[model samples]
Target: MWSFSTYKDKRYWILLITAIIILVLFAVFTPDYILEKTNFVPFSMLIFIVLFWSTYHLWKYFGDKKKRNNTDDSCDL
Candidate 1:
């Protein structure tokens, strides 16, 4: 149901992609000793927070656009 066409702005996508890349780099480059010491809880949580925040903003943008379209249609009648 979701499509990139629905959201014209690419900032959210960029944020999500950047977050994923950072996560991958962290996983690949972080020393084993550091990983073991923290169990990756904090880093993973930060990534999740970024992902959720971007997704929420995207969803809100879509909802607002849809609402504006509906209002415009009603006014045209």
Candidate 2:
């Protein structure tokens, strides 16, 4: 399972970004046959990671909006 703490760290982001750049460079420079027989697992994993990250940010935005609304309502009462 993925942990949010690791993702929240700046160091982790740097590492993840570095890896992604490397992967992209490798894919671009390498021959197509290098990953021709590769399984679908890595692609599935990449998609899953993207979805999870987006979902987390979306929920965070909603949660912050709700908190602000609640505070405003209470202040007006």
Instruction: Name the candidate that leads on lDDT.
Output: 1
Question: What is candidate 1's lDDT per residue for 1-77, written digit by digit as tens?
Answer: 67876366565677668777977897899788877866576877777797767776877788789989999899873
lDDT of each: 0.75, 0.68
Clashes of each: 0, 0
- Quick one: how many clashes does candidate 1 have? 0
Residue range with the least summed lDDT across 10 consecutive positions in model 1: 5-14
RMSD of each: 5.7, 10.4
TM-scores, each model vs. reference: 0.47, 0.49
User: Candidate 2 has which clashing residue pairs, if any?
Assistant: none
Candidate 2 lDDT over residue span 1-77, tens digit each = 66777567564576567657866776778676656757754884587578656755666678779989999999884
At residue 77, candidate 1 shows an lDDT of: 38
Which parts of model 1 are misplaced by more than 4 Å?
1-39
